[model samples]
Target: MAAFTDATRVRSDGEGGFEADLDPLWTVGGKPNGGYLLAILARAAVEAAGTQPHPMSASAVYLSPPDPGPAAVTVEVLRAGRSASQVRARLSQKDRTCVEALFTLGTLAAAGDPRWIDSTPPPVAAEADLLPTPSEAPGTGLRIDMLDQFEQRIDWQAVGDPAGELRGWLRLPDGVGWDPVSLLFAADAFPPATFTLGSNGWTPTLELTVYVRALPAPGPLRVRQRARLLTESLVDQVCEIWDADGHVVAQATQLAAYRMAG
Candidate 1:
């Protein structure tokens, strides 16, 4: 099995460009996961800039779904300053744009003193204590296969309930350590929190922005996601990813369009 880093690896294509093979193991349903695609673009941007700045924030807009094959990532440096670099990256397949993103890169201090804060990590059960989802039969579809890429222990008590909240333990398959880049994928790995409110059908993300706060410790990540507001056709989700040591590693907010069953 290819490690997550190797699966999402991007190679230099030439000046100001890079190329990657989108592995099928990262696809959900029939489309590649949005966060996985964003990580590819972010990696390209960081390399093109040559600043070695860690990914601080990224805002991505998913235009279309790219096939699980070779894709081209072209990056343009908007500004490279002493503190940060801003770049625009676009992933195109067969000359058609699939995803576009603006990335902000900056160095993160390993240690810093915070003045005040009110956020706290949510309580969740240990990974071994949670129940595993039932195994799917052969040819069950690519979604199940994609989920298998990560170890997820969901809080079933919150699922299908009317709390508009979801909590769980999530981590990459064993051998893949946590990194800032991978947090991009982790931010969007959970099922839509809107499902708890009796909403069903595909909820496609229109836009997603993730903020990386700190490096993660080596263990399963604690994932907390909830919906703050919902309209007839839209939902706003907020998520926080806490490292094993109970520190916030990343946070994300996304706006998605809710599609009802026909």
Candidate 2:
């Protein structure tokens, strides 16, 4: 697994907010990626909770285009309960707020009743292989931005391959002692389903959400994703993160607006 590193600079303002300058190379399509900001806000929430079991659910809203330059993340602990905790964070670049989020921490109880529901898992290939290290792969320009966090396998390299819908496995570098939320971090950036819309064009994400049932262990984390174009700007993609054992641990969905670009 490759290393995921960012040159993020952080300092606390006298006022309960923090300012940080995260590296620009990690941005998506030359815009600051959501995972970059989510990680920072979550780190603050995690520290605020001080050993809380784990976060139950977290959501973020994208309000403006995130600048690839330095930005700020402001966090506030809303409430800490004996059984749950809440926190809010907002990400800003210069004077504009780009992302906002709310995080929840709590414990879970065993299901009073046990029942099984229909669910599907990612498909396996008879001999599926990992794609080349981003630096060694073909193509250039915007696609290069994907190199920072994912390693994909083009199952067939179709005409609409990376366009609206796509299928492939991904890995989050083994560094960072293996963060449990790394899967959530991975899920934060879901591909646009209508990749085919731009199979000959370009599309930008409107927003993204991830639900982490679990995360990869401290090593190479595998992720499989597929995107489907729902409309011109309303595209959706779903992905599942799995462990080496072939268990689905985290799932994600994304919304994006499509456009034909140079």
Candidate 3:
């Protein structure tokens, strides 16, 4: 099994460029997971920022789903601020643009709590009280092999009788811990909320935006994914990840193209 760090590693190829191998393990329905792809771009963006090591905000448009292979990332520094830096990154495979992203890189104050907050983590059951989802979705045709990288405990009852929301718990393997970049992956790590609505098959993300709020405390994350709206051929999904300390570590919203399974 490839660790999250190893799977998402990007090496410097040249000035403003990086090289990475898109691991096959991080795919959904044989295509790279959108969040995983965003994490890859985040890694490169942070490194290119020189001093800014965290991706504060990232907005990506998925042009194409690249296969698992060597991919190139080229980053352009848009501006360097006193506290944050902005950069644009592109991931391409076979000379075709696959993902284009704009990232705001900065550092988070890891010690302080939010001054005033209106949102809180969902009331998910304790990890011990939830049922584990299988790592492989064999018959579903979704091919969520990406689940192999993390430990997940899902609320099956809520899934069976969803109330406009899907809840779960997620954590990295024994060795890896959640960081800002990994939190990007966590934001898109859950089963689509559409699953609770009797929708199936691949929900290919058209656009995804993630905000990394804070560094996670050490433990399994509390996750809640909900559907905001759905059209005949598209769906809007929002996901939130709270750390063990009950801090909102990351949040993401995506628009995807989907078809209801017959």
Best candidate according to lDDT:
3
TM-score of each: 0.91, 0.76, 0.94
Any idea what lDDT model 3 has? Answer: 0.86
lDDT of 3 by residue, 4-56 (tens): 88988999996659999999998877778888999999999888878688999
Q: What C-alpha lDDT values do all the predictions have?
A: 0.82, 0.57, 0.86
Off by over 4 Å in 3: 160-162
Residue 87 of candidate 1: its Cα lDDT? Answer: 92
- Which ranges in model 1 have alpha carbons more than 4 Å from their true place? 110-114, 133-142, 160-162
Better structure of 2 and 3 per TM-score = 3
Off by over 4 Å in 2: 1-11, 51-53, 107-117, 126-128, 133-143, 146-150, 157-165, 174-178, 189-191, 197-201, 260-262
Please write out the lDDT profile of model 2 over residues 110-208, one tens digit for every residue: 212225525544454322454433532345345546456555444445424445444455554444533444455666544443544544334555666
Count of residue pairs whose backbone atoms collide, per candidate: 0, 11, 0
lDDT of 2: 0.57
lDDT of model 1 at residue 167? 92
RMSD of model 1 against the true structure: 2.6
Best by TM-score: 3
